[model samples]
Target: MARPDKVAAVDEIAEKFRGSSASVVTEYRGLTMSQLTTLRRSLGEGASYRIAKNTLVKRAAENAGLDGLEELLVGPTAITFITGEPVDAAKALRDFAKANQALVIKGGFMDGRTLTVAEVNQLADLESREVLLSKLAGAMKGTMAKAAGLFAAPASQVARLAQALADKRAEEGGAAPAGADADATDATEAPASADASEAPASAES
Candidate 1:
């Protein structure tokens, strides 16, 4: 490649490295163009799979401030630059590799660390971002429902107690006050007893 073209290529790869959340380098030695096309389609628009020279990839990694990926860029190299959910792309690549024995998984980089082939496979096994988020939302909903019930129970008990107290007070208030009628009856009877005692004394005299 010419010097300017090489510079542009290095810059492009570096840009991809900087822009991506993760990247997986693979050896596509025996895979045909048709299979490559299908594999690219399966990865969707969230990733770009490109075949680049190892020297250029190394330079790009350095330019992008990434290190320790020198060994993964060996053989007929094609890198998958993933910007979206890493698990989904990893799954697609894993499945494709399983079907096509010609494609070899040559490790990867993600989340500020290098990944082994086994690690990449483990990544493929993880649940997608959507699934995990859905589970989180469901858990939150259940928690909120429990919290609402907890708050509502005390409020309902307080309301019932207030109503019962109000009813008792109303019943007490509607009748005469507790001791008024009893006191009046006692006073009237006392005067009769006094009159009876005076009559007996007058007759005796």
Candidate 2:
């Protein structure tokens, strides 16, 4: 890559890293182009899968102030930067890998920590964001007594996700919240941040 191109690529990737909630690095050596497309679509609207050079990715990660991921940037590396609920993306990656062994689930970053391959799979095993939110709302809907106890629980992520969904529903029903992120306009059920506005990128590995 030329100097300017490399710099531009690094900047773009750094922006992605900064904006994403989580990232999963993978090796897609033997997969066909058709398979790659299927994988990307399966990741849902909230994920951006891009094939990137390891050197550029390392520079980008460093630029974004994200560490503990360089070690996984070996081989034909492609990263799925997730902007929405990670469990759904993880599950998609996991299920796709099961059907196609060529796509390796190397490791990933989530919630400020590096995850092992097993840990990524474990994340896939968890209930997806929609499922969790639906179940929680069902159990607590109209039960004002449980609302306080629900918020008091240690599961801040779940609480925030559910609250965001609720707020979004209210907005769609012509009752906008006091303050909602303008960037969170995800047509899908998943929550999208400002970063999710970036279209998924394609690169030659």
Best by lDDT: 1
**Which tens-of-lDDT digit does each residue in 1-205 have in candidate 1?**
4599999999999999999999999999999999999999999988999999999999999999888799898789999999999999999999999999999999999988889999999999999999999999999999999999999999999999999999999998877665788889999999999998899799998
- What shift in Å separates residue 137 of candidate 2 from its native position after superposition? 1.7
RMSD of each: 2.5, 37.2
Cα lDDT, all candidates? 0.94, 0.89
> Residue-wise lDDT of candidate 2 within 1-205, one digit each (tens)?
4699999999999999889999999999999999999999999999999999999999998998887998899999999999998999999999999999999999998877889999999999999878989999887875866776676775887888999999898778774442244435443435454345443433322
Whole-model alpha-carbon lDDT for candidate 2: 0.89
* TM-score of candidate 2 relative to the true fold: 0.68
List the lowest-lDDT window of 10 residues for candidate 1: 172-181
In candidate 2, which residue ranges exceed 4 Å CA deviation?
142-205
